[model samples]
Target: MPAEIALLFWPLVTIALYALSRVLYRHYPSAWTSPLLVTPLALIGLAIALHAGYRDYMRGSHWLLMMLGPATVAFALPIWDQRALIRRHWAALLIGVIAGSALAIASSWALASALHLDASLRASLVPRSVTTPFAVVVASDIGGVPELTAVFVMITGILGASLGSWLARLLPLRSSLARGALFGMGAHGAGVARAREVGEEEGSVAGLVMILAGVFNVLVAPLLAMWLR
Candidate 1:
């Protein structure tokens, strides 16, 4: 295939794969058995087997990535739609988001330091629990590699999806709302989705918390990075 045609072809292939994954996910409800997990790995493995470099694949795929910012912004619409609930619990929700974001970064940094991860890796890891687009920008601003930040975000998502529910249960949380907020703030989108499956109230709280956390992370992570440095 011509280079230009390949550029167009890869993105279409990725979209088809994503659609197929969603279909499969409907059949396999377990986090460990998610099609999101299976499909991406398959596509990546195929890319490797085909000898397609990351840069070449990214040339097409980056268009989807670039839409992340706008998609994130669109999440605000849901928050707006739920403004009444937000107003009613604004104080507690604010406190929960702040506390969750702080714990997510601090705990990761502490663990990474104890594990003897280098400073750059530590910086990347600090924002791992936040959403990927925001985390990548924060990592870049902090002198960490955006690519590394993205990898960490994926790892965090997978771990959160697999263990977050169990961990939420283990915590001394009284309110399902708070539990969901913590999950979303600390685990990003995947956690929010999982919270939705758990319950409607949990899902609503999680969605609000995820949006708040993403906005807060984008605003605060660079400052935290400076302090870490």
Candidate 2:
């Protein structure tokens, strides 16, 4: 196939794979079936079969990534909707985001260090705990590969969602606030989905916490980048 046609086709393939993955997950609903897990694997397989490198695929799909910024901004509406709850639990939400973001960064750094990964990989790992849009921004700011950081974010989210569910069940996280915060802090987007499966209030709180954490991480990323340098 011509390069131009291949570029266009790859983007469609990527989108179709993701859409199909979501459908499969809706029906078969498990960690392995999750779109975050299956879409990437399917895309990788397709790309490999087509001899398409990351750059080739990204050339067409970059627009989707650009949409992330607007999507992240839209998260603010959730905060506005939950203003009353936000006012009541301002301290908890604030403290939870701070602590969660810190721990996530520290743990990623330590894990990368322990593995003796390169500095760029370490930087990519730093924002692995946050969602994609924030992680991509942080990655670029901190001399990490945004694409690599996005992959790490997906892996972290899948694992976090799985573990967050288990923890919610095992731990005495009785309150909606605690349960929602637990998933939001632990898993971000994936966690919010799982939290929604549990309850509406939990879903709302999780979404708020996830947005707050993303905004906080984006704000702190510059300082963190400088410190690393």
- Highest TM-score model number: 2
Pairs in steric clash, model 1? none
Put down candidate 2 lDDT per residue, 76-125, tens digits, no spaces: 78889999999999998899889989998899888899999999999988
Q: Rate the local accuracy (lDDT) of all candidates.
A: 0.82, 0.88
* lDDT tens digits, residue span 45-126, model 1: 8788877888878887888889987887788789899899898999989998888888888898899899999989888887
Which regions of candidate 1 fall more than 4 Å away from where they truly are?
none
Residue-level lDDT for 197 in candidate 1: 82
Model 1 C-alpha RMSD to native? 1.7
- RMSD list, candidates in order: 1.7, 1.4
